[model samples]
Target: MKAMIFAAGLGTRLKPLTDTMPKALIRVGGKPLLQHVIEKLKGSGFDEIIINIHHFADQIIDFVESNDYFDIRIEFSDERDRLLDTGGGVKKASWFFDDHKPFLIHNVDILSNIDLRSLYKIHELNNSEATLVVSDRPTSRYLLFDDSLQLKGWLNKTNGETKSHFPDINPDNYNKLAFSGIHILNTSILSYMQHFPDKFSIIDFYLSICSKVRVAGYTPVNLKMIDVGKPGSPEEAESLLL
Candidate 1:
């Protein structure tokens, strides 16, 4: 199967490190962050991968070419002219994925131990348009799902703001699952994203279309995930992720 790594971000959170180099190039356990993600995907039988580049775009390109893609077929969805955010970045590279199969997306900074094979299997079994890895963890924002694991709303904990597709009635039995920055999406999702221009978040795109499509969440409760966006997070990731 094919996958795309969202490595184009300027990575404002990583500060000095990202100011000089792209976040994907940041090292963890003696290897670049992008390398780790690619290795993980390759282990799951996803040998063909595409990475979007923007911040220190040339450096990322050079590094990937130097390593010979670590034995996996790697392609770059170049965003040198304009750094398209998650939604636009994926939309730009839609042609790389064959319409017959689903594609995986992972952020360069999110290191996780979730079983990709299991997640892929569940997505295929459900015949879902998209399946996101979510956890019952604390976060500033969360994707709300009903008892059936159907995405129902989005909540911003900082401001206590909530937006639900079922606005008329309050959802009484929903769970808040923090998105783990990993997702498996079928090609059909591209058709729904046709209207989004230049730069936009995939999260907002999902919320906009949740009422019409089959967007579900896969909760691997026991899996360990680390959003190594902050300086402190890298410490948390040190022991959990290799």
Candidate 2:
């Protein structure tokens, strides 16, 4: 299986740590966050991987080279010229997923106990264009899903704003789930994304076409996860991951 790790972001939240190193290189659980993700994915049956790099691009490259890429088939998507957000990063790395199978996309900073194999099996069985991993955790923003777990829209609790592809249905009619920064996407949906901007969130792009396509959400029960991007996350990660 193939997967892409989004590691190009200039993680402003980590401040001085990020000022000296890319977020991908931030040590967590006695290793870089990217290393944790790579080991996890490799153990989860992913054989090929591509990681995007921008902030401290060379450092990430050097780190991967230093470790011999953990003995997996690893590739780097250089984003040193311009930083592309989630959607754009996926679009730019489309060539890596050319095998036509559904591939996984994950965040470098996300440390999770998500079962990648189970998620992939669910995507295959559901036969959806994409399956977003979600949870019932408390979050200010959420993705709206219908009774059948189909993507319907998005809502921001902090600002009381809503965006939906299906205008006829009330936003309140859908169940809200917090996105887990992980998803499996079939390459068949790539054709519709050519018109997207060079930099855009996948959430925005998903909502733009959900009405015409099958975008489902999967919320695993009792998901243990965290976004390891803040300044104190390393310490927190040591406690949780170690």
Candidate 3:
């Protein structure tokens, strides 16, 4: 199996620490955040991995090299010239997923106990073009899903803004789920990016295509996750570490 780690973010939320190092290199539970995700993916049967790097790119590359690429097939998707957003980062690494199989995309700063193998299996079983791991958690923004967990639209509770291709979409009519920053996407979805700009949020791309394709959500039972990019999340993430 193959996976892509989104580690190119500026991680502005982590301010001082980020000023000196990329969030992926920040130590949490005595290990860099990137290492935690890599080991988790490896444990879940992923053998090939592509990591996108921008901030402190050289540091990340050096770290990986020092570890001998973790004894697996690891490659770097160079984004040192420009930090592409999630969608663009994946698009930039499109060449790595040439096997035409579904690949897992994970955020480097997200620490979670969700079963990656189970998540990938669910995506294949549903035959969804993309399956986003989500949770019934409170957040300012949410992805709305129908009774069957098919993504319907996005809603920002803070401003009452919504985005959806469905003309009759009603935020109140669907289930609002917080995205877990982890998802399984089929390589076929890359075909939709030809018209997109150089940088764009993956959520935006999903919203624009959900009405035409099956973009579903998978909510793992007892999901525990922490966005370690936040100022104080690193400490909290320690509890989720095994």
Candidate 4:
């Protein structure tokens, strides 16, 4: 299986620590966040992996080289000249998924115990264009889904902002789930990005076509995750590791 890791973010939320290092290099439980995600993916049967790098791109490249690419088919999608957001990054790396199979995408700063293999299996079984890992965790922004877990819309609770294709969509009628920054997408879904710019958010892309395609959500049981992109999250992630 193949997977792509989103390690190119500016990681502004981590401030001081990220000022000199890429967020992917931030150590949690004595391992770089990138290493954690890589090992997890490898354990889940992923053999080929590509990581996108922007902030301190050289440092990430050096780290991977030092580790001998973790003894797998590891490649780098360099974004040193221009950082592409999630959607654009994936589009740029679309060539890597030439096998025409569904591939998984993961965020470097997210620490989670969700079973990746199971998540991939679910995506294949559903034959969905994309399958996002989500949770009922409270958050300011959420992806709204129907009872069948098909994505319907997105909501920003702080500003009462909602984005949906349905003319009369009611937020109160759908289940609100927090996205986990992990998802699987079919290669066919890339064709839909032809109209998108070089820098776009994956969520926005999903919400724009979700009503027309099967963009499903998978909520894992006992899902424990931490967005290690904030100020004290590294410490918090250590406990998660324990």
Per-prediction TM-score, please?
Answer: 0.95, 0.97, 0.98, 0.98
Residue 65 in model 3: lDDT: 97
Error of 3 at 90 (Å): 0.8
Compute the lDDT of residue 231 as modeled in candidate 4. 83
User: Sorted on lDDT, highest at the top, how do the candidates line up?
Assistant: 4, 3, 2, 1
**Candidate 1 per-residue lDDT over residues 1-242, each given as its tens digit:** 89999999888988887889998988878778888898899999998999999889999999988998778889999999998889999989998987579999999999988889888899999867999999888888889898888888888888878887677534345788899889999988898888888788898889888889989998885788788877777667778765
Q: How should the candidates be ordered by TM-score, best one leading?
A: 4, 3, 2, 1
Candidate 3 accuracy as TM-score: 0.98
10 residues in a row with least lDDT, candidate 2: 164-173
Residue pairs in steric clash, candidate 4? Answer: none
Off by over 4 Å in 4: none
- What does candidate 2's lDDT look like per residue over 71-132, in tens digits? 98999988899988889998899888889999999999999888899999999999789999
lDDT of 3 at 90: 88
Residue range 4-51, candidate 4, lDDT tens digits: 999999999999898999999999999999999999999999999999
- Tell me how many clashing residue pairs each candidate has: 0, 0, 0, 0
Each prediction's Cα lDDT score?
0.87, 0.90, 0.93, 0.94
lDDT of 3 by residue, 1-242 (tens): 99999999898999989998999999998999999999999999999999999999999999999999999999999999987899999889999999999999999999888999888888899989999999999899999999999999999999999999999789999999999899999999999987899899999999999988999999999888999988889988887786
